[model samples]
Target: MTNVASPVAVVTTMDGRRPYGTTVSAFASLSLAPPMVLVSLDDRSQQLAIIRRTGRFGLNILSTRQAALAAAFARSGPDKFEGVAWSPSEGLPRLPDSAAWIAAEVDDYISAGDHTILLAQAVTAESAEGSPGPLTYHQRSFGTHTPLAP
Candidate 1:
C-alpha cells in the first residue's frame, strides 16, 4: 500500500557484459537461520531477466543521503552506474557506501501477478560505517528515518 513506507534497495546484477541495476522497494528479509531475502521485480524488466540468467544479485540498502542515486536507478534507458562510485562484492556490483549490502544467490522464482518474486540466499552481507539512516519510499516520495529522543 502507498500508505506503508518501505526501505529502498538497489538490485544489481551483471548482464554478461555490463552491470544492470534498479531501485526496488519490495525487498524483505525472509530468513535469518539460512540468511535468506526476497525481492520483487516487474515481470517485464530486463534486469529481472539478467538476475534469472546469472542466478546472482546484490541488494544495496540505500542511505538517506543516496536518494538521488535511487532516482537515477529508477529511470529507464541509460547507464545507471555512469559516474556512480561502486565496486564488486563477490562478483556482484555493490554500492560501497550504502547503509548495508547483501550478495545473494537466487534459490527460487515465484511468479505473482505482474511481478516475479526472487527468493535468494544471502551469501554474504556487510554494513557501511557511520550510516546516517536508511532511505525510505512512502506515497511515491523518498525520505529517511528520524529517531525520537527520550
Candidate 2:
C-alpha cells in the first residue's frame, strides 16, 4: 500500500446533536452501478459507534489545499473541528470546500481483524466547481498527485 498513494478524505458522523470526524485514507468505491462506497475504521473508533447508531455518514473528499484539515482530523481527540470551516449537509456536518461530498446510509458492516469495514450506499452526492487534484496519504505523509503522461 505504501507504493501507491491513496486519496484522503474526512469522514464525519453525528452523535445526536454533536458531530465527529476523522481522516480516512482507506475509503474507496465499492460499486458504481448502485453508487456504493466503503470506509475502514478502527473497531474502537467513536465515529464507528455513532455511524452504527445513526446508519448515516458524510464523506468529504479533501482537496490538496485541505492537507491541514486532514492532519487535524487524523489526531485522536475531541477538539478536531476546533476552527475548521464546515456546515451541515442533509443534517450531517460537511466541509464546504471539499473536492467532493457524499451523503450515505450504512448498508452493511463486517468485522475484519482490528478494523470494521463499513459499506455505504450513497443517497446524495455533490462536487465542487472546477476540477482539482485530491489530497493523498502515503508513506505516513500527506501529498498531492500529478497526472502521468501517456
Candidate 3:
C-alpha cells in the first residue's frame, strides 16, 4: 500500500500532438537564475515523442476544483482531452481557467532511469485572480491540501 503524504500539484502538458501530454506529477522547478524548470516524463510515455521532437511544452497547473478533471486524465484511459477545453495559443497548447499555467521551451533533456528530464524556460503564466487551492497527488489518489494555520 502506498502511503499518503503532502499533496503536490497535478499538471497537464499540452506540449505536442505526436506525444501529447497528460496528467503528470514529476514537475518541479530546477533553477531561478534564468528561470528554469524540469518536468520528468516517462521514457516510454507517448508524450516523449512530441516533447523530444518539438522541444516545448505547457504546464497547466490544476486548481483544487479540478480534482475530478485531474483524476479523469490521470486514470488509464484514452481521449484524455477529448471533452476538455483547450486551445492552441501562440502555437502552444493552453488550458482555460487553470489555477495557473506556464509555457516552457526545452533547454535540455536528461535521461534518468525510466524517465527523461525536460529542462525548460518559463515563458509565460496565467492564473485566476484571488486565491485557489490545488489538486495534489500523494501516494496514489487525487487529494486536496490542508493548509496549516499560521
Candidate 4:
C-alpha cells in the first residue's frame, strides 16, 4: 500500500486516567448514514487492546503541520504524549488544531491477516474551520494533498 496515499490520523483512547494513542494511515470512512469509519490496527497493538477494553476511541486527522505529531505517536512508548498538547473530549484524548476529529465507539472487530479492523460508529465529528490540509502518507513519506485544477 506504499503507492497509495492515505490520510494520517492518531487513534486515541483512555486507559484508566492515562491516554493511549497510535498513529495510523489505515483509516477510512465506512458509511454516511450511520456515520461509521474503519481503522485497521496491528493485532498486537496495545492501543487496540485498550480499545477492546474501553470500546471507545477518538480519531484525530492530522493537519499538514502536524506530521511531527504523527511520527511521535507511531513510536512504541508510554511518553508519546509527554509534551503533547491535548484535551479530553467525550472522555478521549483530543488533539487541538487537527484537520478533523471523530469520537467513536467500536461496533465490531474483524480479524484480517495480521491486523484487526475496527468498525466504529461515530458518536461525534468535527472539522477545524481553517485548519491546514490533511497530512498524508505515500511511498513511505509524509505529505499533503493538492487539488487538481478543474
- Tens digits of per-residue lDDT, candidate 4, 1-150, equal 799999999999999999989999999999999999999999998899999999999999999999999999999988888999999999999999899999999999999999999999999999999987899999999999999999
TM-score of each model, in listed order: 0.96, 0.95, 0.83, 0.98
Model 3, 94-150: lDDT tens per residue? 666667777888989999999888899988766667647666777777777787999
C-alpha lDDT values of all predictions: 0.93, 0.91, 0.69, 0.96
**TM-score of structure candidate 1:** 0.96
lDDT of 2: 0.91
User: Best lDDT goes to which candidate?
Assistant: 4
Clashing residue pairs in candidate 1 (N, C-alpha, C atoms within 3 angstroms): none
lDDT of 2 by residue, 8-117 (tens): 99999778778899999998989988999999999999999899999999999999889989999999997787787789888898996788999999999999999999
How far off is residue 148 in model 4, in Å? 0.4
lDDT of 2 at 136: 89
Q: Which residue pairs in model 4 clash with each other?
A: none
Candidate 4 Cα outliers beyond 4 Å, as residue runs: none
TM-score of 3: 0.83
| Root-mean-square deviation (CA) per prediction | 1.1, 1.1, 2.8, 0.6
